[model samples]
Target: MDKDKSIDHQLRATWQAVAKMYNEQAANYGSTMAMAFVLLTIDKENGTPSTALGPLMGMEPTSLSRILKSMEDKGAISREKNPEDGRSVIIKLTAYGLEMRKFSKSHVYQFNNVVREYVTEKELDSFFKVTSTINKLIADKEIYNAISQDK
Candidate 1:
């Protein structure tokens, strides 16, 4: 089978391209794509629990720790002891972080608008359906069990 016809190949290639473009654009604001993504995931008003951040953003603890530290050093976020949970910390956006988040939000909106301009609503619906099916398959462990059965 041709690699170009593979769904995994197409998905991986498309995502890599998207990440590169986003990182390039983020560089203009003195940020990286990951930083921008973390900023956007944070709640503007209320703080998010440090433990929940990893799962929420699908980031590894080590990687997220580095990003959080860098953001703190840059005055983008503040970590405070959780009032409700003594064992946990809350990640809050600094005033400057809110400003950066606004830009991140705008960038996301611009990307969506550009995609909408090129793709029809019907096409987006179909794309969503495919992605949803893929996610369901993974969540149900169909792919994992399928390979295990052949062993």
Candidate 2:
């Protein structure tokens, strides 16, 4: 087989493995990338207003509301009226959510370590650069812009 095909096959296999791992966790939490992004953002910001989070996650307002409501129902997130903007609602992680975040932490760390073990540091850096470059082209820039505008 040609080198390019061989590499493609390996990449696909690796991606499948990663997807399987992600699915195992995501299924348990009823999580998607949108959900994970919200969790990660709340972790970083302590809390964020609903209108702001909508664009950040590239989700429609209705979809974001549904996800937030589910999280709230699960006791994974709490919503409060924004002090500065009473019309906007703020979303925060509950203690249970924080604990669930911790559950994913080790898995994420180990996944990184696994990748690092197989790929050199320079390769990892290159991968990140390429990944970001591709994402810039593919990711919804409008959504990002809307989020920034909110900020």
User: Each model's TM-score, in the order given?
Assistant: 0.95, 0.69
lDDT of 2 by residue, 1-151 (tens): 9766674577678778887877677778766544655676674446888788877777798988887888888888998898998898888888877876665665678788987999999998998896676577557675468778999
Every candidate's lDDT: 0.93, 0.75
What TM-score, to 2 decimals, does candidate 1 have? Answer: 0.95
Top model number, TM-score = 1
True-vs-predicted CA distance for residue 54, candidate 2, Å: 2.9
In the range 24-118, model 1's lDDT, one tens digit per residue, is 98899888899899999988889899999999999999999999998999899999999999999999999989998998889999999999999
